[model samples]
Target: MPDSTRQRRPFRREGPDLRRRELIDATLRVIASRGMDAATVRTISEEAGVTPGLIRHYFETKEDLLGAAYDQHMTTLIEMSQQAVEDASQPAVRRLARFVETTLSTPVTDPEALQLWAGFIQRVRRDEAMRRIHRTNYHSFLSCLEELISGALAARGRRPSPDDLKRLTIASNAVVDGLWLEGSALPEMLGPDELTSIALDAIGAILGLDGLNDDLRKELDK
Candidate 1:
């Protein structure tokens, strides 16, 4: 355990938004390294080089701070995935491949991220605020993925029903989520690049894009 006294330092006052973000980040770091039980206002204040009173000024309660942290975590994941697929220079197939690859790679595949997610996911079962955050982020992730799938299918001159698109999106999400869980939990089991390749192949098979899979694999080899 860190010495709280030594951890305390002069707090630099900032604008409300920046200070709030810093506190939320501190809360996440504490939760990830020390567990959720240790992320009280005092601990987070120490982590942020501030006082408990300052933390309270930003967050009315500990649960509010926690909810903000979880929301930022989920927002980052969604942003990265969306950015990967939004590269207009890339073909639809390549964009889809990049989305799968990015999701299974760093930032998302980090052990700390997995730890934070695991810790907050349990609270979702009992915390209404956490549950709402989880549901909103989850649906946002799915919506982005579905858009990518539809674009890729259209590029191939194939039009599918809404039901088919939903099914494909769910399956594709499962593939990425499964690989992400395994890679984050057991990094030694597979190399990062290897995990990415496997994800691309699995997603290609799901969407019946074997040719694009070959292109993606070859591109990675370059």
Candidate 2:
């Protein structure tokens, strides 16, 4: 462990949100490495180098802490796309490509992200807060997707129907989800090159990028 982590192990912050954030991060690190069943308050507190009581101080139950961690991770992931979409330098197509790349590329494509996501997704069926967070991120990224798709299509004077936009957004999100999982599960088997080729081909076909110059195709492939 680094000295910074060593010094911060006690996690004795005065603010509730700050303390909760620390514990939530601890929950992620622990649950990401060990399975969720192993993520007791004792293990998480030990991971945070704080006491189990501290977890209860913020979260009434282990489920609450787990939900908070899931929320934080999803918020982080959504904000990544927000930042990428803020880049005004690229054209709409390239910007869309960058958004897809940011979504499907590493550390987001790492096993830790998928493991944490799988844990949270399983819990969502039972946990109301987790379910809300699930819907929140989906809607949040759906808005971003709508913007990207609308911009890319409108640049060519085509505006999809609201229903079509909704369906396409979900499909695009599913494509990213698949790429993320495949990369995390079989980085060696699929490799980034193969993953990129397959993903670009699929997304391009879906977005109607079937015809373009070699340069633009290479740009999208990038």
Candidate 3:
């Protein structure tokens, strides 16, 4: 995993928020490297270099800590996408292309991320809190993608109806999710830049955006 994927820790470790975030990061690292089942209080405390009592001070139960970790994971992914598209100087098309490229590229598409996601996914069905978190994050991601799709279409002088936008958003999300899963699961199957190229092509076709594939390729290459 790249360093960019890992959450940064504060040098001064006295503040509550900083300490809590550190604990969350430690929990995520444990869940990613070892299975979630192995992330007991003792293990997480050892990983965080804190006493189990300190862990209790921050999180009342293991479930609370796990939930926080899951929230952090989802937040990090969303923040990366937002940052990629936040350059006001860039055109809408470039922003959309950057969003796809960043989502499909390293760190975000890493094996560690896949493992962490899978670990939480297995529990979402049985845990009500986990299910809620999953729903919130999933919809938030879809909403962001929909906004980007709308911008991309408008950039080309095409304004989609609400129904059209809904359908297109679902399809575009499927393209990103499908490619992300495959690429993360078996990165060696595709060479560098292949997954992003495929994603841009498929998304462009789905949205009926002619020349979008080429446009995105040029945007990413630059």
Clashes of each: 0, 0, 0
Worst 10 residues of 1 by lDDT: 1-10
lDDT over C-alpha atoms for residue 122 of model 3: 90
Q: How do the candidates rank by lDDT, highest first?
A: 1, 3, 2
| Error at 77, model 3, angstroms | 1.3
Q: Mind giving the per-residue lDDT tens digits that candidate 1 earns over 180-205?
A: 89999888887678888888788888
lDDT of 2 by residue, 67-173 (tens): 77888898898787678769776777767766776676676677788888987788888878889989988888888977887787777687899999788778877
On a 0 to 100 scale, what is the lDDT of residue 81 in model 2?
65
Best by TM-score: 1
Model 3 clash pairs are none
In the range 84-185, model 3's lDDT, one tens digit per residue, is: 888767877777778888898888888899999999989899999999998999999888888888998999999999999999999988998998899889
- Of 2 and 3, which scores higher on lDDT? 3
Model 3's alpha-carbon lDDT is 0.85
Clashes of 2: 0
Candidate 1 global lDDT: 0.86
Count of backbone collisions within predicted model 3 = 0
What is the C-alpha local distance difference test score of each model? 0.86, 0.76, 0.85
